[model samples]
Target: MYHIPNKYYYRLHQIRPRFKNDVENVLIYMATCLSNLSEMPSDKFAKAMNNAIKLFPGNANKKDKTINNWRTEISALFGLIETDSINQTSKPSNLAFKLSENQDLVEFFKYFLFYFQYPGGYLKPHEILDYINQGILFKPVSYLINVLQEGEKITEGRFYIDKAETTHCIFNDLRVTRQNNPRKPKNTAYLVIHNRKNNINYNWTGDVIRYAGDILDYMVIADLLVCHGNKFYLNNKNQEVIVSFIENEVIFLDYIPLYKKLNLNINDVKSLNDAWFYFVNSKLDQEIFKTDLYKYLGVDSTTYQDLVLDSINEFESKLEQGVEIKTKEIGDFGEGLVLGHEKMRIKRGKREDLLHLIQKIPTQFAVGYDIQSVEFDERKRYIEVKTTISNKKINFFSFHLTPNEWNTAESLKDRYYVYRLAISKINRELHLIQDPVGLYKSNKITMSPKDGADITFTEESSQKEKLLLWID
Candidate 1:
């Protein structure tokens, strides 16, 4: 019941010349019977074939011979083999014949079966091309359809081309084909371009613009061009523009519009915007985007490693004024300062084990708390530090607390404190915010949830109570 293309029959004849007469009918019947099934029993398969022959009367009389011949021909030609075994009753026994280990042939038959079952439906040519590229098909089925041929007449209607508006570019050969009814308003029209050139170095900006103009006269079109391992588009000015097509523009322009039209939240837009920026700029390649442990251990696996190593040789140059330190090193130094401050404040009797008890969980398990310190009264202080190399005067210190950390802060109540440290070339400043969850609940602070972290604001808080303590 499936429409088998003439090319499939031609190819089958070329592959198996002996079973040329039986291939088409037998394959179609086999594929249709096995379409909804992973494996079919011998008795059930025989019954299905008998029913299929009655439907197609040409092979009705040779039902038994045809079924036996097809089982052998299918295995030999299409790599579908039957497994058989002798039963204890000494009667003839057979197991289900499954598709062979040949993945390409199996995929082809699967596609062919689907197409056969669904007779009339729109199947995109690019989808077929994808199948070919993915090894589902042996060859380009689109090419065999004769649709991509140059100057091929596609129906009775003629596609008018304006001579005066045509660009003097050689690659701009546009062909428009209309389906069946030319006079109908909703008639489907396909825009096909025949690129017969070998040299791809030449600029096709003018050609693209001309094609767009030609297509626009008949229909609205969004064009995509793949060239030189990059995607390009013609802007409003007819200028060729290269963009991170798949990463940024395509998803942003196509998908985000639908999301916005549906009235989605601002968080969705913000997340998508961040993702697009990160993808376009290749942010993952930088050391800052690497694992926090990698940065904490000063593991430089980037191209900047050699430059940093060379800088180490120039000790005087390294010690020069205005020399910036890495963010991780600044963070570690801040933790050291906090540890020293805690060590000095703790009772003299417990001073020996103060550093050990500080925990420094970031290096160990990357837990919510960075350091566990003891107050003057011997009470535990759970401290999470946020460090920045930027000057406190010009930049506002921002800290991110994970959901786990937020829950920890809520559970610990007054014992939880966030230390925001700003390190400049000459001086270091630390600001502490204690009982942050209580502060937020009392409307003393504001926060935004981003990427599984609560981005709490310090300067943006509208609290009358100033809980910030300046650590000397």
Candidate 2:
């Protein structure tokens, strides 16, 4: 004679959540008990149902209806229990002990890793993503259970993982409902589940395995790969396996932070090619592309093509794109004048970035000018700019630098009037340059390699002279 357990029903009510498979799992478990209880006396089954209802949260409000429904279902199943002859003595739980064992879970985790490594397969690692996805049962189970028991009405909570704050909440709309909550920015409940599930004391040891695998993947794609002695800086962080993979001395930590902390001098570069070679071959501990072989022996530049170069180029491109005009018109100026002002504004932003790169000044919005005019106090340099949509290649001053600019330059150390014009022809771009002396210099200004390879008098010219400014 078997009867349903109140604990199973209580767990079932907790599982009827809006997300995950908890509700379905509970139903399956309940079905098993239902089949067994059918053989028991009707009064005993009724008593079991009463006990189950008592554990539910709303039991007081709907006790009569709930109890009546259970009695009716038991009555209906009594005939089947008597005639169907099903034995549930050996099936106390819906899931088998072996199925729920840690060993089985550990095996599943391995399969998951294999699938992530090779995703075309059916049982991909993301199947375990529920363990990480936001707003699901079994996610932050410990945290949720604790909060519920504390009567905290937690509605919102957060946990720190890998240096990022991730939120945990029961209601999906809790984010919206609790918008004023302090943890809104780091409101990622998805990762909370990931950490919680991973910390489970199951037989599975997939947490460390997956963490190591992910770190290895990132390290392999690093821009300036380095491996100093284990005591060195690169692998200095907690990631031990990755530290073991590198040969020679390891820097012991990630690059940017280490670079900043060590205050490494990335200055006084002569040529981009030379600087890149030095960084890769020596400091970065990476293999350098054979520039000599490529130039004289006609070899492929495959060695030069790497993730580091690609990422660098992409970053530079983004900084370039940031120079575009966001606001169209300010006050009653024609399109030509308005665009010129915007161009100067964007150019000023680029100048600020350069200053930060050189560690000269941290402020991006330090200098300002009203309308199309600016005055440099150092040299008493007064500049008045005029712009045109035309493509004519006249003396640069003909566009913005009037004859008066020449007189102003006499008192200024480096007085400059910049003419910016859009060349509407195909393959033509906007032209801009500083006409300080109203003449081009005899020799180009050289830049250090660490300052970045491409240096231009103006943003437009910088793009044109991409190869000329690299300092080795």
Best by TM-score: 1
Model 1: how far residue 325 lies from native, Å: 19
The whole-model lDDT of each prediction reads: 0.36, 0.26
- Tell me how candidate 1 scores on lDDT: 0.36
RMSD of 2: 31.4
Q: In candidate 1, what are the lDDT values of residues 362-444, reduced to their tens digit?
A: 44355677789876556789988765432112133345677878888889998998876654323355677787888888876
TM-score, every prediction:
0.29, 0.16
Q: Give the TM-score of candidate 1.
A: 0.29
Estimate, for each residue in 1-472, the C-alpha lDDT of model 2 and write its tens digit: 1111332211101111221112222222233234333335445655665564343333456657655654343222111122112331111111212112211111121111211211111112243122113211221222222222232122243222221111112222233212122223233344344445566321223332232223222232221112222111222221232222222222212222322233232221111212221222222111121111112112235523432253345346647867433222111112223233333443454542322112111113322211233322212222332322211221121222223344443334244433333321121233434443433343332221211111123453322211111111
